[model samples]
Target: MAGFRYEEVAGSIAGQVEAGVYGPGDRLPGVRKLARQFGVSVSTVVAAQHLLEDRGVIEARPRSGYYVRLRPQRPPQAPERTRPEGQPTQVTGQALVLRVVQAANEPDTVQLGAAVPHAEFLPTHGLQRAFSGVPRRYPGRATDYLFPPGPVELRQQIARRMADAGCRLSPEEIVVTNGAQEALVLSLRAVAEPGDVVAIESPTFYGLLQAIEGQGMRALEIPTDPDEGISPEALALALEQWPVAAAMLMPNFGNPLGHRASEGRKREVVALLEERGVPLIEDDVYGDLAFEAPRPWAAKAYEDRGGVLYCGSFSKTLSPGLRVGWAAPGRFRDRLEYLKYAASAATPAFPGFAAADFLARGGYDRYLRRVRGEYARAVARVRRAVARYFPEGTRQTDPEGGFVLWVELPAEVDSLALYQAALAEGISIAPGPMFSPTQRFRNFLRLNCAQPWNGNFERALRRIGELARERSG
Candidate 1:
């Protein structure tokens, strides 16, 4: 019993709290008293108290005593902020790099985890050609940080381009980021706090989930339709039930889900949030890479206030290596821009300059046409492969645009095990669980339709399916 003194003290105190004997706000015995009761040293009692404090069981008062702080309740979560309104008051933390490493180290694995495009889709040679000319056009631009809002020429180009989507932006509103990830991270950091709740799509992007986890914030998962994106009614309920500080969503071809929110719903969403004074962070990275007929509208088009923070990246349309993404933070422009500067100083200027050149060549739309055509064909091939290889009960989302396929396997199949099993056969796939804050997609997998259904990819899918069968069986 002597050796178990600290354990006894901690357990008895914890039991008191659990039993409501020491109700919230009630004071616990001091070190001397607890030591006398438990027959432990004063230091031992103090250590036990500190342990309880760290566990959020009690709080220390300044010469007053340790009292229960009521384990601070979090109000229910609200909907994620949609476009054209609301600030993204969410705190995001460090990104997970383990899954990335596994996929990178084993090149033979069937690739499907990351949102990165196939190496062939990248315009590496074209980038090189443009880079070579950067010196002649702006000799020292690459050597310097573009600063807060970004390079003037690049920002102007972005403003001019967004005109197509009816997003009238002043060059002053745009802040360049290393990638869309940085834009989301910085926007969240600017608007949210450590314990604030942020609503997100149920089967959202894993990276966003990791960001939420890293920031020590709470994620409220909202029901999302495969076609129409997040449910408006469900979001409104969340808003009413929870004290959400902000929300983040991918309005256009959301990562992993590959669904676009309708323009009408977008307006309704913004208006609802504006009434509640909430902010929205819109991820539109795949807005331009739609494989469907015409491009969908931008969420920012409906903005009448400063709540919407719009994010886009050239990685999908141009080159990932470029890592060029920009944000138009309507009301929080200064704060978002300052965060961008503080976080990374600025995005590499040469890429922005080169991207401007690429866009200015008047071939940007033409290139998009070609890219969409290829993506459409690729999606078709992958769909057929899924039909042929995956089990009969498998349900897959047919995204209207973009190149992600969220496949729901039979309830018996566990995606985490499938990921491990597939990796053994030189294949990689995103396990379903990572997409939600609580890892709810245990029976799901996100397939990248960006890659062609070639021998390697098909073989990978076949192996993944086989693994799924093994787990299911």
Candidate 2:
């Protein structure tokens, strides 16, 4: 207990750093002074300073005392309110989406395109160890097909994690799928028929659009606020005007925009949909990656009736290669299970077993705390870089969570051209049009903030900004 006193001292210093008491590049009190202030020994103050230095909150000079590191600067402004057409638009960005997604996966390229977290931030070694033990632990289970609903252990772990998002779910209510993509597909299939119009957030994830188009459904893009998420007013108006079959949304840390709906807004949307008798499918893959304390609530949390189908995945938080995802489809549970059965019969057993093992071992929460802090710092660094390098007219989203930034460039700068130019330079960017069904947001682009901040990433960002300036000129 005496040896751990430094942690308390370090936390107090961190609090000061966060509270702006010790601003960027400002000198902190000397070790003796801090020791006297905290009533701790000089050795304890030294340990606390080391901890802060390791966490990147402060730095030490060769001959001088410690000084605060420069915090990530704020960007100019968030993008204005989105204005998408009210009517349904046929989805046609599948080919472009596929191309950009493939490019994002290329090796040796700076990846600022895909919304996936960098491998450096994930628990790759732990997951691999878990996977290694699965075969020996469950001899024949690895080879045999897991039943439709998937392994009970994995489902139970997922249900426990769901509570963090304000949803209390039973393991039996969850259906395991290959990934959140499949869960979303199953959810969409369970509720909407072919050719039905589904309302979605404008500038949403391209994968959602591809899935909607693949299902032979139309998309009605709703006006979304950068900070508050999809407008309840716009959604209510769309429902009143159109024959909307189902509504899909990412309420917490939405991809591209990274907008999170408030609890009241989420409840209002749910009540509106419930009154209209429309099923709601929620993609919450990024919910667990919130940078703030006390994770935001999912839209499913406010579901008084049973119209919310909540889909989540371990890909973002853990290894994407695991391909483990689950859906808690309320009221339509039977239909969703049937669809999951028809699609693949069962998810891969080993990944489920491994994930279950990982979660049960009690390491996930610790890992989340580490990664959440890293991602928050990384996002701030990326925002500061954008502000320094991007054209003067550029505006970007100040997302509360997740690792992606939506940048709105001048209208004269076409994002597609910027994408191509950036790709040639070994940089990948998700062009804005890919996120919209009607090819809107041509002047915007989404950048992945998951990668650690370094000189290489900074160069890539500057190059993209140069390309944008050239095009605009």
lDDT scores for all predictions? 0.75, 0.87
lDDT of 1 at 372: 73
Cα error of candidate 2 at position 346, Å: 1.1
Error of 1 at 23 (Å): 67
Model 1 worst lDDT window (10 residues): 72-81
lDDT of 2 by residue, 429-466 (tens): 99998999889999999999888667899899999988
TM-score attained by model 1: 0.78
> Residue 159 in model 2: shift from native, Å?
0.7
Please estimate how well model 1 matches the true structure, expressed as its whole-model Cα lDDT: 0.75
Each candidate structure's TM-score, on Cα atoms with residue i matched to residue i, is 0.78, 0.87
Positional deviation of residue 193's Cα in model 2 after best superposition, in angstroms: 0.8
